[model samples]
Target: MNKKAKIAVTRKLPATVETQLEELSDAKFNLDDTPYSEPQLIRAVSWADILIPTVTDQVNAKVINAAGPNLKLIANFGVGVNHIDLEAAEAKGIQVSNTPDVLTEDTADLAMGSFIMASRRFGECERMVRAGAWTG
Candidate 1:
């Protein structure tokens, strides 16, 4: 890795991740923190050596095809890569990767919520509270 890859990040990530990416490559951040328009995505694909897209950024076949030959890697920031077109990237010889375990904490919290709701009958309690019938 003598030559640093020019990386384009599609959205605002956590500070730690931004720092790491900055250390690793010529990383560019989206300061606006908004999803890219289709034209902006196309331009990013053309301009960058690597593209770091979030779940909100849809990297479909059209965008992938618009990428320059310099574009080689698509390192998605989040768990889901369904927003990106796998076959398109493969066809263009671009490698695709993602953080699959990114939602582990979220999933665990959701599971705990479900258990607590069921065991305590929170739904019924909430209904009563909303109806002004809950004394407590």
Candidate 2:
């Protein structure tokens, strides 16, 4: 922790987030915003102390096994950790972290939309509510 941790980000982050990460660590960003192939991902994992990968970036056992001793953490930039190989990471003494509940709002929005579209019978209720005509 005394020295700058080498961080490899597998995908592009927001400008502000990237800047902050760079300030904190020796961050290597995916400037082109291109998804890494499995081989490329292995190389990245083999080269850094920390890895920041998106949900779509599958960090499986093979990739984990190929990681170098310097690779200590995999900080997934998404809600689910299923994409990462937890068992492999544990065996390697590497910690895995993720952004939990990051898609709560999006999930709720999708659920509500699905509910509303479940039946067209609620169309009048929807219009009435929008028009401030619904008392209940």
Candidate 3:
């Protein structure tokens, strides 16, 4: 792999993963974890050979078009490719990839956790406390 191959990551990933990316390639990370604006997205695509966008980043036609000539891949961080314009990517000969089923177990665990929390009225209790309505 070319050490100069530029990879733009649109969100802050886990520290270990980010470290690996840094070690493996010329990875540019969005350490702030904020959603990229249209111009920022355009800039990222313009600069990167590959982009690692998350659910929050919209890889639309405009973004695809803004990609530099070297840009070849859009590797999404999440399972949903709906955020990306697949037709436009294909038209531009940019390959789009994603980690499908990546969140299956985590999503299920969160669902179950939320179910238990709701059943226990944990949110309501927190609200009560926040509102200074706790009697006990």
Candidate 4:
């Protein structure tokens, strides 16, 4: 029997997605609370057949070059690809992909809620309550 492909997850992800990957391939997840540095990220990519990363993690040309020919896919967790150098990845023959429209509604909702709260002086109300100044 052929062995399953190995993948490296560069950051923490929701359990639902992680479970899906666990069923599909050999997945290694980073458990440390701290983020991985560039050198550490390069080392992880060197051994992976696929890489799963977040928007904050940068996958640059140097990192792609250090992949050592085993790396195949990069699946980003966010819609933005600013952190990745697509041209460099293409030049190195690595496939790159991102999750689009997944969190659009949620992000917009949160932004609207924050705007409402700020405009209504919600922070002042909370501060007054904490200071025992509620006369009602």
By lDDT, who's the top model here? Answer: 1
> Judged by TM-score, which candidate is best?
4
User: What TM-score does candidate 3 get on C-alpha atoms?
Assistant: 0.85
Which parts of model 1 have CA positions greater than 4 angstroms off?
A: 121-136
Q: Over 4 Å off in model 4, which ranges? A: none
lDDT of each model, Cα atoms only?
Answer: 0.94, 0.91, 0.92, 0.89
The residue-by-residue lDDT of candidate 4 on 77-111, one tens digit each, is 88988998899899989999998998999999999
Scored by lDDT, model 3 comes in at 0.92
lDDT of 4: 0.89
Per-residue lDDT of candidate 1, residues 1-136 (tens digit): 3988899999998889899889988988888999998899999999899999999998999999999999999999888899999999999999999999989999999999999999999999999999999996
Worst 10 residues of 2 by lDDT: 116-125
- Sorted on lDDT, best first, the list reads 1, 3, 2, 4
Candidate 2 clashes between residue pairs 3 or more apart in a chain or in different chains: none
User: For model 3, how does the per-residue alpha-carbon lDDT over 1-136 read when each residue is reduced to its tens digit?
Assistant: 3457799999988789888888888999887899998899999999899999999998899999888998999999989899999999999999999999889999999999999999999999999999999999
Error of 4 at 18 (Å): 1.2
TM-score of each: 0.83, 0.78, 0.85, 0.90
- Higher-ranked by lDDT: 1 or 2: 1
Alpha carbon lDDT at 95, candidate 1: 99
